[model samples]
Target: MKLYTEDPERILIYGGSRKDSGEIRGIISGDTLKGSFYYSSYGGGTLKRYPVAMLKRENKWLLGKGVISIYMGIPSYLKTEPIDYSDPKFIFEEVKK
Candidate 1:
């Protein structure tokens, strides 16, 4: 298991502090949305890369939880498995280009 310092309450996507900021790069596989997100600190700073996984339910992309770590100096994205739509704090929408 990889160790991470991310608190779900501090994620920006959930109206929390700017604790997470990263490039929206993901692929929709079946009902699973696999993507790569990064976390920041104190509103702004060096962005650390991590993984992100969301579940598509009823045409809505909901957020999930995953691990955070750095191995071999590679940007590891967040890996989320399971859909928790019980009371989601953040729902990923279509990124306007």
Candidate 2:
């Protein structure tokens, strides 16, 4: 992932697969980062946008509780579910360069 924090308060994060690219536009307030996560659908050819809030703890970005819609199947069926931040599969790490 690539992060652009030129405005300090405003941050732009970009990264994903070749078929689908993801971008996150976040606003820094205190130690929290509030923003929207955007990505392109692999099969639907549509843009998926969702709200995301993360808190900075010990240099790691921890995801806030929220529901996200995930598209499944060929025709693109959306299933909205609560995000499990405590799960190891749900990773929200900030890479340092």
Q: What TM-scores do the predictions have?
A: 0.50, 0.50
Question: Candidate 2's residue-wise lDDT over 1-97, tens digit each?
Answer: 4343333332333345434345667689997776776666553477666667776777777766655444452221123544445642233555454
- The residue-by-residue lDDT of candidate 1 on 26-89, one tens digit each, is 7888998776665565447787666666787876677775445566876554435343446655
- For model 2, which pairs clash? none
